[model samples]
Target: MARLNVKPTRMELANLKDRLKLSTRGHKLLKDKQDELMRQFIILIKENNALREEVERELTDSMKEFVIAKSLINELFIEELFVGSETNVELDIHEKNIMSVIVPQMDFNIKEADVTSDIQYGYLNSSSELDEAIERIESILPKLLKLSEIEKTCQLMADEIEKTRRRVNALEYRMIPQLQETIRYIQMKLEENERSSIVRMMKVKDMGTNN
Candidate 1:
């Protein structure tokens, strides 16, 4: 590795050694964070997949039932039956940190949240299929929200892992090696200077004895 372009002095060597120690420690910590983040990300990905599958499957079934019910009833009457059924959904959004990366957390509450509370039509105007379909759709709402949170968390963690990998690579491949090489070069220069000083002193002593 290439040594740093620094003066070959004892003070510079000490400074380089201190930097190397900090770099090594920081590298290890970043590496560990990357590993743990990967583990958590993998688990979240699996859960996201499973939850997505479940939500999609239920949504598909409910849509089929809804289509059948629509065909069985007059279109305009269907609209009339379910009119003025709007309810406010309160969303509580916040963040949580994982390995120093912030990810989203969301909680929601539907006003007066009984799944069938909005069914205002009389029994004579609706079929079993329509009621069941609406109920199923309502029931899956929370799961859909949860699935969104997991997917978003996975995305954030993936980004964090990539960043940590880059930092670890920088310290491992560049900074640490440069410091070590510089330290060795300075030590060699110091040793050479000590030898030259000893030789000069010995010559002076020999000349003095001859005089």
Candidate 2:
């Protein structure tokens, strides 16, 4: 509550009053924005947590199947099969706005091919476990990518929410109060000046009447 270092005049008081009105309105709007951002951020966090859990569970299952496949197949044969494999995957990145924050959206472009035919190794050479493992791993890639995108979005939104919260607090606690104090100070000064002028006029009239 420090008063602003401004001259105590009618025009200055009027200006301060207008500025306080604008500041109060702006504070309300900013507080509302911060509240909405927090709501949206919480939703994103829950979604990220669920997606992360699902991705982890699928990855664990896929890894277990891969370990079993490795034990059943020749190590050199596994290396050779992967070395000659042809799988094309492309990612297209784009942006989307959530509450004025731009976040990333990713889309996968997988080249068209017969997945069954793409298993280049002979069916007899590779166990069914190996085929299943490969399929599961491939299926997890898109989900993993989606999880990455969601986590990043959550981080960015969290940062924006924090920034907004700081601004709202500053306006609510600091600027508005200071403006109010200054306005009160100016009004008091103007009232005191008005009383002094009236008293001086009364004294002048009394002296003239005596003469």
Candidate 3:
């Protein structure tokens, strides 16, 4: 909106012109980056939403099975059932770069070697409902880990996109305009100075002829 306070000269004008060109080019690059970031962010969001829905559905089913099993058995026995049973899930996390944003790539490792023996309780006393519930829950661990990874990536990308948008807007609305205005002002001043010099030269030549 305002021209920069600079000395009016051809040199200044040339410098301003170069700056304006650079600023314009930078603006285009930043705008393109912002657009591409948005595209990737949207794709991640969609995947996060879908994976979340599926994980929630599976969790609900697992909870239902547990509830049914609890109702059919003695509540005291249910507490003792899983007293000695435990499964450790470990996350092997790695970083991935997406459009300059670093996101987590998660892999879950189940510690127990024998998947079937994960149920520490004796089968004779455990209800079929309990078994199915435990199995389903164990199966969901990897998906849950994956869901976390995607959601985290989405969050990181969203942050990056916001930062990029602000830079683009600053260049487009502020820096570029100010540089262009300053360049124009310098060019006009230089032209006026040139005209004044020509006029002075002509007056001197006329005076010499009159003498």
Candidate 4:
């Protein structure tokens, strides 16, 4: 059973009334917050859907290109050209905040392995097509990483929206009603006590007059 902490006296009742007013105001603000969160969540879902489709398409294309590149590299006779050269690849990535969302930031440097100045076997690189393919791969990598971050952020926001909605619903459908009920009960009890006191006082006065 829920009870309001209303005082037996008028002074306490006045204080309780003020508290009820504040509680109502807080409830309204929380409800508004919940609504705003839900709206944002819906928007994010739409954006995420579009992003997902784009990322899938791009990744599919990238994978196809990757297979072709791999096959070409394997068939290339670059053993003499790559001799004594070292391959050094470095990737530095970090997260940055944007509108409470964390997105990926990346910097990458790639050094060809065993790149010899000899051109005898360098003919294996037959044309700049492989160079272009590698550049595209590098370019698409960051985009994929960014999409991953965005998708994760969308999920996180969705979870937060769900939690906020639950709280709002509880306050609207349960807590507020219970509080109002308790207040009503307290008011009724107080009124009954006042009436009983009045009756007792009247009876005592009548007995004294008769004496």
Question: Please, what are the lDDT tens digits per residue for candidate 3 over residues 64-144?
Answer: 988888777776667765664668888888999887899999878886643343334555556778778878988898888
Instruction: For candidate 2, list the clashing residue pairs, or say none.
Output: none
TM-scores, one per candidate:
0.87, 0.91, 0.90, 0.68
Q: Which runs in model 1 stand beyond 4 Å of their true positions?
A: 112-124
Candidate 1 lDDT over residue span 1-211, tens digit each:
8889999899998999999999999999999998999999999999999999999999999989888887886677678656634556788999898889999989988664344444456656777787787778778888988998899999889888999999999999999999888999999999999999999999999999999
Local error of candidate 1 at residue 176 (angstroms): 0.7
Candidate 4 C-alpha error for residue 141, in Å: 2.6
Clash totals, every prediction? 0, 0, 0, 3
Winner by TM-score between candidate 4 and candidate 2: 2
Compared with the true structure, what per-residue lDDT tens digits does model 2 show for residues 1-211? Answer: 7888999999999999999999899988888888888898888889989988998999899999999898888788888777666567788989999888899998987664444433356665688888899889888887888888988998888888888888888888998898899999989999999999999999999999999
**TM-score: which candidate is best?**
2
Q: Candidate 2, after superposition: displacement of residue 178 in Å?
A: 0.5
lDDT of model 1, residue 149: 89
RMSD vs true structure, all candidates: 2.8, 2.3, 2.5, 4.9
Better of 2 and 4 by lDDT: 2
